[model samples]
Target: MSDTLSPKAAKLHNRTLITTYLYEHKEATKQVLERELGISLPTITQNLRNLEAEHIIELGELQDSTGGRKAQSYRFAAKHRVAIGVALRSNSVCLCAVDLYGDTVQERTHAMSYTNTPMYYQRVGTLINEFAATVAKGGSTVLGVAFSVQGIVSADGTSITFGTLMHNTGLTLETISQSVHYPCIMIHDSDASAMAELWFDPTIRDAVCVYLERRPGGAVIVNGKLYQGPNQCNGAIEHMVLVPNGRQCYCGQRGCMDTYCSLETLPEEGESVPGFFSVLEQGEPHHRERMHTWMEFIAQTIVNARSVIAGDVVIGGEAAQYLDDSDIAALKSRVQQLTPFSTDTFSLHKSRCADTNSIVGAALRYIEAYVDSICTDAE
Candidate 1:
């Protein structure tokens, strides 16, 4: 968007824009890209050719012959340029890899021991490399690694200043970035997920989105861009105390929203948020009662944030996987009970991404960085 941007950088930027478009549209012909990107025919063809050479995308079979000629459609070679994304959770680590699109080509998860300054970084470091190596398709180049830990990332992504679960945040960035043999980037899970939402769901563009995830984060998206606060912690809502003198939080706060409603707070062991919701659906009164109380508490916090942020709220997380569309609609009804906003503006629901949502989110962060670097070099 800047004239000062170099030609190469601009091309990379356009490539990114186009890739995002193709990721959204799945398959597009040259004419489709020309219209969608507003680029000349030669430029579109050349970029497509270059991308194809890089194995970023490939031409599909021809569509119906139009008024002129049957044009070949291009689809992402999601297996071509791979990137790994991982979320650092208190109880476990979630890993995923995707293409330019937020489509998870591969994913894996495992329990991680508590984070020590060094051991945690080493463990996460090992996991990232292993995941990338194990699942990547043939001859694909892993562009970079992205992580969406549940804390505030430094402006330069050099360190994470806050994370009870991510104890190695400060050291891990440097170590991982140095040792990964790829471009390493990090972002708060809240904003990372927001980026994933933007790429994965274009209907969210020019729209404000509120994401409620189990990792304890929030984000404000305007016109397809994430609104990170000046401190790069705009969505740092894990510390927001929803109830005074209600419960103790790991962050040394009383009654933080996470303390009350996070899926991690479920009292029973061996119960995931989704699993609990399943039991509730089976007419288990115990799960139903606890879930109702949790939903009410979450609804209250969202009502306040909704009034302040004022957008369509998207309820997503590992908890959302088990919830059907009807369940989300019902949850929306529950949130409306507390909010004065008209039902028309409220769109509360579960993210369909399941556990891979954050993983795809992490991949996008690296993809953006990859595009930026290419564009910068192009210029």
Candidate 2:
């Protein structure tokens, strides 16, 4: 077997290395890239030229030189391609366009009840096409559209296997893709939120995202990657039983963690998550007690989950903004009391991308795919 890569393979590898570096650093000179990436100056120049031709990279103003000639700076054109993310809720839809750097270029939320009819899906697709056209006004390519739904998505990303919140189970991507021009896929909201968390903090290797929205959900990250498991249901923590023969869950289970830890139950009828937390913070005795009881259930759930997968935990979603240091401390104390292992092994924190995480994460799928295609010569 040959020890060295073929010329074509070497070219692809060098281009991947150079592009990856520029994607991270945002800007670099040919000389700087050659030195830092340890590639030949000729190879760097050729790759940069190719990228410029494709509009993936652009030439910038000359750098101020300390000596003779000023080196020309090359900038990664992040907005050359844009990914569309659609977050489908029970009564509204959140749409956002994201660039290569995972920054939102445009975002909007529209009030519309979800119905599993072809007309409804076609309307959603029409809205996405309009959004894509607006994003494309600046000459950016519309990469694809990703739908973040509240359910378990199949590994193929074509259909929702388990959706109850919006009654969208069995919905196929083709239904929406028919009216839209771009490629499309469906993603579970919890997994989508986890992707956003990963983008916000790339250093996280192993962790669990405890999504405390209207319905409790979770995502598991192992070895710095989302673990969908064989059934694509590895992180379905909502159905984890907490109390036997207790309140029934939407999944037809009794005392599942969702029945107890859901933020939906924390707020009173017609009260918002913020309103409930505000009253709790105002020294309301009953509200405070209610929060305490909720925290106990949340801590119990965390400890139970940690017993199987000993990773750091992040509490996120709609209610994440309301959690304070005191709440975290209380949860930690309770977790310590319940945990069989030392709580010091795993740390806990609140979510940084609370509300926008799912939308951003959904769009990231396309962004990541575009990068991989370029790096692997798939394009």
Best by TM-score: 2
Residue range 3-22, candidate 2, lDDT tens digits: 28777777788888888888
**Model 1: number of clashes?**
7
**lDDT score of residue 338 within candidate 2:** 88
> Residue pairs in steric clash, candidate 1?
6-379, 7-379, 8-378, 8-379, 9-375, 9-378, 9-379
**Candidate 2 accuracy as lDDT:** 0.85
Residue 153 shift from truth in candidate 2, angstroms: 1.7
Q: What is the lDDT of residue 227 in candidate 2?
A: 84
User: Per-residue lDDT for 73 in model 2?
Assistant: 94
Task: State every prediction's TM-score relative to the real structure.
Answer: 0.77, 0.93
Which parts of model 1 have CA positions greater than 4 angstroms off? 1-59, 62-78, 134-137, 205-215, 264-275, 341-344, 369-378
The per-model lDDT (C-alpha) reads 0.71, 0.85
Which ten contiguous residues of candidate 2 have the minimum total lDDT?
A: 1-10
